[model samples]
Target: MDHLINHPGILTAFSVIIFIMLLLDLGVFNKKSHVVSNREALIWSVVWISLAMGFSGVIYYFMGLEQFTQFQSAYWIEKALSVDNLFVFILVFGFFNVPKEHHHKVLFWGIIGALVFRAIFIFTGVELINMTYLPEMDLFGHAARINVVLSIFGIFLIVAGIKSWFAEDGDDGDKDFTKSPGARLVHRFFKVSKNYDGDKFFTIENGIKMATPLLVVVAVIEFTDLIFAVDSIPAIFAIAPDDPFILYTSNIFAILGLRALYFLLANFMYMFSRLKYGLAVILSFIGVKMLISPFFHISSPVSLLIVGGILILSVAASLLFPVKE
Candidate 1:
């Protein structure tokens, strides 16, 4: 942690490599079409996710065992949370009727924005956690604060999970990011078009100008990301204990994979109906763990086990009980 915080080379290198990759992805690979195929998406997904894990290993080898553990825990929590974003992305694309090839472009921009916003968030969060220290002996009080916050998150997940579980029944739930508090404010002030023009976000058609549904999809993607940020950020804290490097690296890697993940998993999303249950359980568990972290001091090993177990169980359940078309 000390090494990473002090040495600035890591951030610079990470940015240069990631940006270059995106250029290749958009400018080279996904240069055409808006709709992506599951196979192509999965290949890209594997490439990036493998890269991320490999990067984590490098950090571990260079930094130390301790930092690596922190990174892994944070990574696991974030990876799980990202699955929720899958459903949200599906909704955004469905509502906007975004073409497959164009989805990559949207996510390309999204990754850029998300990484920037999250950097600010990580820096601020790390500073606060470091500066503020509660009485060590008053484990009771410390635990209580942790519990209160975690419980709130847990409750949020429980509700979200329940909503997701029933979502298949045609309940729209709170799935629309465009209707979020901030997005709503933006919409009220901006004059927007009523329909789409393929990949074009804004254009003049005949005598009138219009904003494409693609633009709306982009808006929904960004807003939904922020909401996801809220849940994911807290979840990571449960594991890595607010180490900025671990938090940031884990988050960025998971986010970096999202575009590819979406492409790969889009078609098979229904197959993972049990994933909702897995995510729900994971979220609810993390919320509980966070709420009681101080009281219980749950070992990282235990955290790892629970997280892994839930994931396996969920995947198994999904395989066993796929949503039939």
Candidate 2:
């Protein structure tokens, strides 16, 4: 529960670094819109992973082993949960028929919005937990103050994980943008074009400023990320409930590389057919851990090993026994 790196200097430094990296990524490297090649995606994916791992080393050097373990646990959990987000991204892009060349544009803006929103969610969650009653209770065979807010997060995760496990895949059902309340509200208030005007989200047509289909797709993508964050944010909270720095940094690092990860895995999504079950088990385990944390303390290393093992086994199983068409 010790916040070793909760200093203004550290926070400010990380914020600046993240801002500069984002500028370099979007402004310099990906300034043009084109289909992201496998090689490019693979290379960037490694870059992002290496950056995250390197940050863990920095944490270990400055904060010691305990904090480093917490960061690793949070990072792995967030990264694993993000795979589900990538799957949904494929669905969203396909649903809108977003051109391959424009996909990065939408995702770039989507990630920007996500970073802002997730920061809000992280700070808000920490404040709410701090406001709750802190009663010394026996948790995990140790005397610790039980957090009502965290327990609620645990319950939500358990429910969500169960629901996700039983949920059917490839079932878009009857949902459409026209049926979406947000889409309808936007359409009512703005002038919308039926077709895309290149990759522009806005264009001047007949002397009137209008929104393009691309704008709609971006809106949908942003909204979808917000929905996904509902689950992912809490999952990370379960990993590092006491340290907002660990939680936020891990979440942001996992998300920053998602565009490349999306490109790498989008074509091979079907190969990981059992990933949902693994995710379900992981979420459920974390939820149980949170709930029982008052009575049984599970160390961060144990958590990391278990989560990594589940994901690895699920992926291996999927590859060994491919789903039949």
Candidate 3:
């Protein structure tokens, strides 16, 4: 497979688009911390999704159909898996009693952290995968090279899928987020104030500068995304394990849109009550794909169709079978 990174023009285009969007997102549109309305969230969601699809078109133009489908598959997988992250974000905000106005700021910073961490995970994972390919040998009459890392990741994702399938609702709702390692890491390093001071992450109380609950919230969010990546990153690896460029670009585009998505869906949680089941199937399907890659290749187009179909069905089921309030 040809690596997208080899195309300098495409790389430049991807970088420029991301840079400009983020600049507009933080430096311009959201310059002030204010309550984001549903309309605004909807508009931004459309903008981001359109940008992602447009960029995928660019990929198809330059990298051909295979890479385009790879991008689509990875992008949707990350987007689907990330719904679970939004659920946690809601709980975290509620736990901290975070003011409605500050949710975007928290999610923005959380995504920035994700952009960096995901690059590290995807690139490092690709190199590890390259190193772990077993010597080719006959396995049931066909010679194939199996990657040890991908095999382990496959098993892990399958287990994660099963766990997600049977997972109970409100599992994290009643837990104390203050006990989270993310919060503890913040408390160990800085004196945290008892109250918030506007949208500031730091506050001065009694002539002492201290971290506010808002900062603790960001830390928790960052740590939460890192943990979520354990599943999400590996799932994407099942799509384009050898092409870090495809993996990272698609993973980032999906993540960049999540803040808007969170706001848009925050009030419509019941509409996706059945999404976990769909995500479980997607994860297990990707895991099985990875496990079988040595014996049979699943074309990216088929993978894209399956993933898109599952997502559509999940949302339709959620609407039709509407979870009783």
Cα lDDT of all candidates, in order?
0.70, 0.82, 0.93
User: What is the C-alpha lDDT profile of model 2 across 1-325, one tens digit per residue?
Assistant: 5574556666676688788988888889888788999999999889888988888887878777777888888888788788887877787778778899899888888889999999999889988887874879765567887779878988999998898899887665335755455456667878998878888988888899999878777777788788888988888777777688888888898889899989988878766888888899988998888887777788887888898899898889778887676
Stretch of 10 with least lDDT, candidate 2: 173-182
Q: Report the C-alpha lDDT of model 1 over 6-42, residue by residue, as the tens digit.
A: 5467667677778788788878987775566777778
| lDDT of model 1, residue 121 | 74
Candidate 3, residues 163-251: lDDT per residue as tens digits?
99999977998989999899999999999998999889999999999999999999999999999999999999988888999999889
Judging by TM-score, tell me the better candidate of 1 and 2: 2
Compute the lDDT of residue 225 as modeled in candidate 1.
Answer: 85
Per-model TM against the reference: 0.83, 0.93, 0.99
Candidate RMSDs in order: 3.5, 2.1, 0.8
Worst 10 residues of 1 by lDDT: 142-151
